[model samples]
Target: MYNFIENKNTDGVVFFTIPSFEKTKLVKHGFSSKIGGVSKGSYESLNLGFKTNDLKENVENNYKKITKALDLSIQNLVFSDQVHKDHIKIVTKKDCGKGIIKESDIKEIDALITNEKNVALTTVFADCVPIFLLDPVKKVIALAHAGWRGTALKIAKKTVEKMIQVYQTNPKDCLAAIGPSIGRCCYEVDEGVIKEFNKEFTNVDEFVFSKGNGKYMLDLWKANQSTLKEIGLLERNITISNICSMCNSEIFFSYRKDEGITGRMAAIIELE
Candidate 1:
């Protein structure tokens, strides 16, 4: 199980700490909120995405604060230029600080995985689900960004598969933490998305329900959970944060809730 830790810094962000791996010096994982940065106006503070209209200096400063709070080195961080796809990149020590300084250095990736120690894998999001996977036994960690399209592609399960293939990790020994995102209460989907989800999910009714007015609400968090379980992870190994980015826009950024002009939060995982 994982325990949620609220950051003392006014950033309103909370990270989940897994008790089973706490004593091990293997991996560190955290999901960020929008409370602790130097940006102003639309971005406000703690925005991690550099492509946003926020000042580059503020984004850099915010990265410093986040690294300090997470007890990680900015030099070893590897970021993703997410295109909402299922492309998972296997990061190595040589790829450190790639996407942060040079946008061209960032590969078109949506998930990052690595077994190397001290190399952080990061993915940015506004309302998309940030799924963090850790194989404490294998000392492998992966971070996934799953929006509707990525979720339909089963990116979370693909990340687990990659870990197993690349690092010899077992899904049963892996623990997953599903982070804050747009909950079903606010994630209304149209008929096309709902139909596609039905095709992908076996028990589609459980995660997708009618919300009246010809709209349907989809529980992406649970969808990812089911995907993990289907990929051999035990149901008990998944820990989901019930926080909704859309509902709690004051604490976290939401692209749909904020009309796409918002900053992004980050979910990072690394082997220590």
Candidate 2:
């Protein structure tokens, strides 16, 4: 079973780490929970997205708390604009602090890959899949945000392809984790969405379940796993944290559960 290990720092901030990534000793990474922060209502603490209506100061504080808890640096954090597309960015040390401590040039990008140590790559999410990738041989790390649109667009596969092109990362030597998000149990989609999936993936039956009335339960976790496998990543190297964000709304931020207006949790990673 692919599972995430729960951890809480002395500051009371809670986050999760992928056991497979932890075993590598190549990076510091975690997915944050909405447990400890200063934001109020709806956002109600640990809202990491600056685009949200949550107070900017509160969001910054939340970053500081999460970074400290993850043993990451707030100043080195680089964020993705995440337009829910398949676009990717290659991050370097010079890109550190963008969208956080400094102004950002990253836009229309949903995936970020980096080989630079100490430069953290982050992507925010609310009821969306967060994909964490690592190549131990190349000492590379990447983070991707895969919502329904991104999933259909094959963002996960594209990210891996970019890594292979730029860093010459071999899929066989990589480890990946599908972080928490809205699960098939809660992710109801219409025929239009399913059509997109059918166009990109041939084994839709493995992850898509019809509920009638033009709606279906789509398993993004399984869909992403299929993407990884299609690119030659071993099934044993990929992990899926089957936790549903909407189901565990108390611990996570779920846009659907909160009816669109809610905070965003972050999936952060940095080479140690």
Which model scores highest in TM-score? 2
Q: Model 1's lDDT to the true fold?
A: 0.83
Candidate 1 stretches with Cα past 4 Å from truth are 1-3, 9-25, 102-104
lDDT (10s digit) by residue, model 1, range 103-153: 436667999888888888988889999888888888788899999989988
RMSD of 2: 0.9
By summed lDDT, the worst window of 10 consecutive residues in model 1 runs over: 1-10
Q: Which stretches of candidate 2 lie over 4 Å from their true place?
A: none
Q: Indicate the residue-level lDDT of 186 in model 2.
A: 96
lDDT for each residue of candidate 2 in 1-272, tens digit (9 for 90 to 100): 43898889888899999988888899999999999888999898899989999999999999999999987889999999989899999999999999988889898999999999999999999999999999999999999999999998889999999999999999999999999899999999999999999899899999999998998999999999999999989999999998999999999999999998999999999999
Q: Using alpha carbons, what is the TM-score of model 1? A: 0.93
